[model samples]
Target: MKVKLMTALCFLLINSGMLNAQVKDQKMGELIDQQFKFADQQYKVLAKNLPADVMPKTYNATTDKVVTSNTAWWCSGFFPGSLFYIYEYTQDAEILAEAKRRLTILEKEKNNKGTHDLGFMMYCSFGNAYRLLHDPAYKDIIEASAASLSTRYHPAAKVIQSWNSSDRWVGPVIIDNMMNLELLSWVSDHDGDKKYKEIAVNHANSTIKNHYRPDYSAYHVLDYNMETGEVLKKVNWQGYADESAWSRGQAWGLYGFTMMYRFTKDKQYLDQAIHIANFMLNDPNMPADMIPYWDYDAPEIPNTYRDASAGAIMASALLELAQYSNKAESKKYLDASEKAIRTLASDTYRSKLGENGGFLLKHGVGFLGQNSEVDVPLTYGDYYFLEALHRYKEWYL
Candidate 1:
């Protein structure tokens, strides 16, 4: 483990500008270190007993419970991905080993075509592994995952179906599907397969046409007619109502399009991302702390559950969006990202020692309307929180 750790550090020194010592905000920099310190301890304990063949989903504080899933689950990659981010920042050898172990457990899902989340499940974990380790095997896993994901793409609908026809979703292509295109884009570049990029662009263009309203707010799901290329319904599968903005869904749209802009350099994709950002950042319902409620239109308003996961995802996306925007526009996103990170790092969101079922961030909502996973610490929450931290240090500092 020590030898591998040293070799990885040596590679980090030569491969990228990801390592650093410069400190822009002394307070935040110190806070970042403290955050990782807590995380290092928490994960060491949290992951010490992980199932031999699966991934942790979220920690349930109410029941003192820890739920886990097989690699086929959509969220199965986040635990390892978050660990990789922490390992990148702290160079913790044990963390890296745990992440690698989880990655191997998750590797079999490369051919899972039953869902559209291969990108979330495979790319998030293996993608980070490939980026940091530069391992050729990781690329092979990613390419196979991309192939599995592309099978779900419907040519007539011009979108990747997020789910098979289920009692709830019914062959819908949700806003969340935007997050999966990164894998497709990467395969296009690495394998010289234009088909992968073509599928991603088609999905993006179709999503813009059908999923978004005039105000740039998005519905959580859009039921599509694959045979006729028709939109059947636009509704929120996870939020309060058909008209409400599920906070994390909005974040997915924000991050997805911004990422699409990065891959394709399409002005329309950039404009779409900017429009979504403007709507979300300026919403009257946005909380003072910069963390958003589970649903923007929840009847309870201030009393509704807050989704720290959404806030974390948005902050990470905003930091990157700031880099692409003009100076005047950039400040809003950068400031928003900074404030959100500060709030998450606070005792308000950050867990106490060994508390919150071994999760780092607190108060994330999975699906309140379904009476499940409400106000718990989620794996994706921690994943995006670490990602936001990584962005903060690299971009701001």
Candidate 2:
């Protein structure tokens, strides 16, 4: 009789778990559907207001105007990238049409070597274009853009120069540059050129060596001397202070290293990504909702702005990292990502339909130290939020 009781209890527990799984799946499906529907509407309004010659950058709620940037802007690809993501979910012809239109203007950047954002400027735009359309034309553009990005790599420094020499620093390599390595990795896979992959690997290695604190949190910028391959300075140009942890910088590192693991299957990269993920998640200053402040160590923590962009990027990266983690670690990463996604989808972060200048998410901090684009809807924030949703749907759902 006791054996039968044990068997019955086991059966009940299994059924309960299965039922909970079904409920969770149902909720996630509904969330993705609802968000995508609203995203489609928001982007349509954005499309109407966007000028034909430039890309959407941010919206000034106070000014009630959509800001624009030229093709060379680091964030130029995000608008088109967001459109492609919406199209992927909604299959909206209008979104696809708008994306193609922007692609025409952005294709000119394939020859632009002056910036290290070609991956963001070209890959996020053309990469999705090719992934969705499988067009030879987009492939050609990606190849050219990869070549252009290659020109920025300094062999001695073993890293890509993020920005040209400024009066303050020369050969500055920012953590954001890590996000651009995807373009190089993609090119190597298709073009049969190992050189692009080598550059990406070298860059990742150099970043691992110089850009990180001992705790695995990354710095915003590391200026190196190109000739001597020496790191001249570790600075926080965009964060609260020189040693403070910039929230978006950490997100970029997490996403970039996770992506590097995807391309190279390097266990070291995966380990680094996991460490960064843990450092960000375990930090005492991280908000309960998983939406971090603009800087992790920002002085006015409770008073500071929450960076939705950082949250979105971290959510997307964590979801991918979950795939490569052990069972316990995977659950931890997935749970954090789910919490972040739910928070960002809430009214506080997700913009209302026809509001927020057609952007999906809100309260992104871009260069808060410089007093620019603070607490506004950023194109990249929307892009990564959509990406996190897509990853959840694709990988978890």
Candidate 3:
């Protein structure tokens, strides 16, 4: 009798846990549906307002001015990337058409090698288009863009040059450059050019050595001596202090390493990503809502501005990272992501339809140290928010 009672209790517990999971998934599914619908509607307004040849950047509500950027800007790809994500979810024809129109305007960047943002400016926009449509024309454009990006690789430094010579740094590589490596990785895979992949791995390894601190939090920029393969300095250009943790930079590192691991099955990259994720999520300064402030170590603490862009990027990376972790770790990462998704979907971060300059989320700080785009709805914030929502819908719910 005792044995039978114990067996019955175990069965009851297991069934209760299963039931709870089902309920949670059902609630999350509804939330994803609602957010997608809202994004689809909001982006239509954005598409209508965008100037013929430029991309949406941010909006100033006080001035009712919608700021835009040329194709060469680092953020040019995000607006189209967000459109692609929304169209994938909603199957909206208008969104799809707008994305294509923007692609035409952005296509010329494939040959522009002067900037390090080819991966962002090309891959995020045309790459998604190719993935969705499987168009050979898009493939040609991607190839050209990858070639352009490869010109920026410095063999001696084992890292891609992020910016041309400037007074700030001779050969500066920013943490954000990691996000661009996906373009190179994809080109290597598709074109069977070993050099692109080689450059990517070398860059990743060099960044792991030079960009991270003892605690695994990444520095924003590493000024390198291109000729001799020496790191000249480690500094934070956008964070509050030279050593402070910039929230978006941390998100970029986490997302970038996770992506590298996906393409390479590299345990080293995966381990680095896990360390970075933990550093960000477990930091004492991380808010209860999981949306980090603009700088983790900012002086204001509770008074600092929250970066929805950082929160979105982190949430998206965590969701992907959860897929590759052990069962226990996966659950932890997923729960953290779900919490962030819920918070971002709330009114506090998510913009109402037709509001926030038709952007999806609000309160993004582009460069708080420079007081640029402070407290605005950033294009990348909307891009990653939609990406997290799409990831949840596709992989989890």
Against the true structure, what is each candidate's TM-score? 0.92, 0.93, 0.93
lDDT for position 5 in model 3: 31
Write the number of the candidate with greater lDDT, choosing between 2 and 3. 2
lDDT of 1: 0.86
TM-score of 2: 0.93
Query: lDDT per model, in order?
Result: 0.86, 0.90, 0.87
Lowest summed lDDT over 10 consecutive residues: which window, candidate 2?
A: 15-24
lDDT of each residue in 80-130, candidate 3, tens digit only:
888999899889999999999999999999999898888888998999899
The list of candidate 2 runs beyond 4 A from truth reads: 1-26
Q: What's the true lDDT of residue 272 in model 1?
A: 93
lDDT of 2 by residue, 194-290 (tens): 7999999999999999999999988898999998799999989999999899999999999999999999999999999999999999999998778
Runs of candidate 3 with Cα error greater than 4 angstroms are: 1-26
